[model samples]
Target chain A: MSAGMPFYVSPEQLMKDRADFARKGIARGRAVVVLQYDGGVAFVAENPSRALHKVSEIYDRIAFAAVGKYPEFENLRVAGVRYADLRGYSYDRSDVTARGLANAYAQTLGTVFTQESKPYEVELVVAEVGDTADGDQIYRLTYDGSVGDEHGYVAMGGGAEQIDAGLQQDWRPGMHLADALALAVRQLGADPAGGEPRTLTGDQLEVAVLDRNRPRRRFRRVQGELLTRLLSSEDPTADVPVPDEDDSPRASSTNPQTQRDSERDQDRDVDGGADA
Target chain B: MTAGPESGRLPSAYLVPGSSSFTEFLSAHAPALLPSRRPLPPQATLDAPHGTTIVTVTFRGGVVMAGDRRATMGNIIANRDMEKVFATDEYSLVGIAGTAGLAIELVRLFQVELEHYEKIEGTLMSLEGKANRLASMIRGNLGMAMQGLAVVPMFAGYDLIEDRGRIFSYDVTGGCYEEHDHHSVGSGSLFARGAMKKLYRRDQAAGDAVRVAVEALYDAADDDSATGGPDVGRRIWPTVGVVDAEGARFVTDDEVAGVVEAVIADRRDNPGGAR
Candidate 1:
């Protein structure tokens, strides 16, 4: 080791350097997105292989997304899912929020990154949509174990800066999936010279959502032909999917979407109510 | 229970610290207690009963999961009405192929593990986490797989966030792969998969998906002797499960009977399948 140095940088500087290092690493991967819809958020990503997905759901209302090393990110995804599920099981499902899950993941990642040399090569996002339109929360987790509470919309992956700047133009409170997806695709598809936004079809991209109208649990993947039709649909928000008879949807009076859901449950509650 | 090769004292493995995953915890405390951690013949491959044809298709608002009632050993029909599929842990169902006895044991053990996790940790693991845990358990059985007693499982469950069901397929060695739209596992998978390719639709209703499953199982049994179809005369049919926001619900025998009856009636009219 070299002898006495000027030591201009402070402890805070060291942490900032580490945080920046971690952020840069996260910025080098393909961008992942989580867009809030009427019922929930739709997470879409540009992944080629059908396997090694960059998206997953951690809880009933919480979905997880990652961009970086497949195994590393996948490990984190599994852990987050486990943690969220465990929390939901321990407490009420409503208690499992993006903020809590993101914090847990951040702590684990940060510990590994600092305690171990090979930092977890992944950046993740956890999203939870509330019963109300204003109850949505998106939490971004960095590779070095830092958590950031993101509002409105957040983007992760290699070209996030370029992608975020692009999404900034159209991202709004009530943007539907078609426009939201178009914005995501455009940012992901943009070339170096910034030609026409690259076209991303259903086969090339993965999409999922947590609809607002749904009761307690949210999280449903919209993929393949569904993705195709949704991408082409003019108003996906208007076409709120009705709850299947098989699904035991539970929504309180607080949620707008539950207006219909509560009635349905009430009918069932009067009928063959309890789960045998 | 654990025993060391030389040093006794319940084995040092039982005293080690590790992840709370019951699968991993078992791998350390009593490796032999795991399905994949057993000794077997040089060539475990034999005329053992192999389960067939499980299918899952997502509908507009929910999803439908199903399996055929057949188990075969090579060219021999081992059992006429064996349930090759089962609901392992609520909100999730697993269909097995290869080594009937072992597969059943693994499924039962898995069910216990999930329940145990919930009881111990005070929460159920996420659908994805459950899948990974299964993968690790499968990996631990690699030794048995090398001997030919392989167990491949098809996993399907609804993700509350995505609001759509997800399916996972795995190899004997525990490689977890996610299937996009629909998937099948077992001896008659190829034929069943082909049937799904033609009939499955994103807009399919849960009832429609169940019909598609019956049709697929019929097709699988038609081509593969290892696969089984509905036995109307004996009142035996496929064991089916569905998972959505409500949770995993197995198709009652009565419901299966209704679908099987309708399917039989349909097949009686058109031997070549109705589009």
Candidate 2:
């Protein structure tokens, strides 16, 4: 007996079908924002899990961020770390670069997209900050293995177009970390020009940065009381004065209703569709 | 995994759950790439230059480690400016004694090893953990040790957990022993250790501890021909490192030179060193 004849799918149709499949798969995940601040590059992702990370350090200066399927992006992140460590060991530490890592991921994703029946549903960003503001670099790699060098700001995942448009209006070349983080959170929290905006608290957001001011290692996470203070400090309606340098819990707990009122006010402000 | 385009996409080793140790990872993926994996001829004793005399001492708040600048091959001085002491990390110092080439390579590998662990685990290795990792690295070089090209390193670090300084000394066969108070290794170690025993005090200040280390090194240089004294003419002094609760810091040459001058002036009078 002979096996059934394979269905003849046209090359054009096959390529289109794969592209649509990958896009739809990625469109299901939440968005991530990567931008260049005065100090270095920063990453903001909408993730609730404290254990699972969307942003991670790949080397001393380079950082990796991703959005889409958790397992797929997580595997890519681990592989990037392994690659960077091996290269640094075999050569010098200065030899490891984000460009090389981006190209490597492109090769891997390109192979899986063309050769395999199902493509990897993941989007990645590899960023490295040089000693100066002009030296910062950010690379965005798509599910189909296309890599693009982004300038001041780049957004990925669902509703990226609207977020990018919002970032385009507010992003500056040399904003401070606090201002830049505020801009990112505002853009991530609000929708386009006129739409209902979502309220994302510090607990729902994951943020990190590749700070050039740091020594050899640049990547560091921003979370806990620091994140809350950064967000609340910028919001005018929060009505809560900036916490002391100690960042004691007593200050935040002193006025639970005040904090909730501020959050609820933000919800109403976004729901009202008031443009920035 | 070193799986180039020619090898499909990734090496089979990439799929396997590898060890957290970078050395073990290298051994599993590419054995020949490892420094200790290489073999030497049996019964052959190489005549490579060997560095000498590393000493470490724990004082009130922290520790001091210093090494003489000398390397010898047979009866001839191979190098006069060999740097035997290296800052392994932010809080740790390593001083090498034994085969010069292998020792330097080992130090570099150990640095990478610590960094690799920190990156993988997102935490700094403890002082004891760092010492044990180094001991295993030296153990991996057993093949070369048997060929008379041994590498014995003295490790010292500020223990974050214990809130004090600690020292660990290793033998050629990879035996790691925690040295209390102070310890020394290499050709001139005996003299250096003797000088330390006489001058060391449990309540010595940071500057006093440094003075004691310089005194011990001067004694080593005086007794052992392989060890070198401070080179006032060339402005080359023994490399001195201090590790406190703050972190590991190198004593600037200017500062060390000041102390050397003071020591030289005191030696003019007593010749027997400060009691």
Best model per lDDT: 2
CAPRI grade, predicted model 1: incorrect
Best by TM-score: 2
RMSD of each: 13.9, 11.7
Q: Candidate 2: global Cα-lDDT? A: 0.80
- Which CAPRI quality tier does the interface of model 2 achieve? incorrect
Distance from true location, Cα of A265 in model 2, Å:
53
Query: Over 4 Å off in model 1, which ranges?
Result: A1-17, A214-217, A233-264, A267-276, B1-275
Q: Which residue pairs in model 2 clash with each other?
A: none
Question: Lowest-scoring 10 consecutive residues by lDDT in candidate 2 chain A?
Answer: A250-259
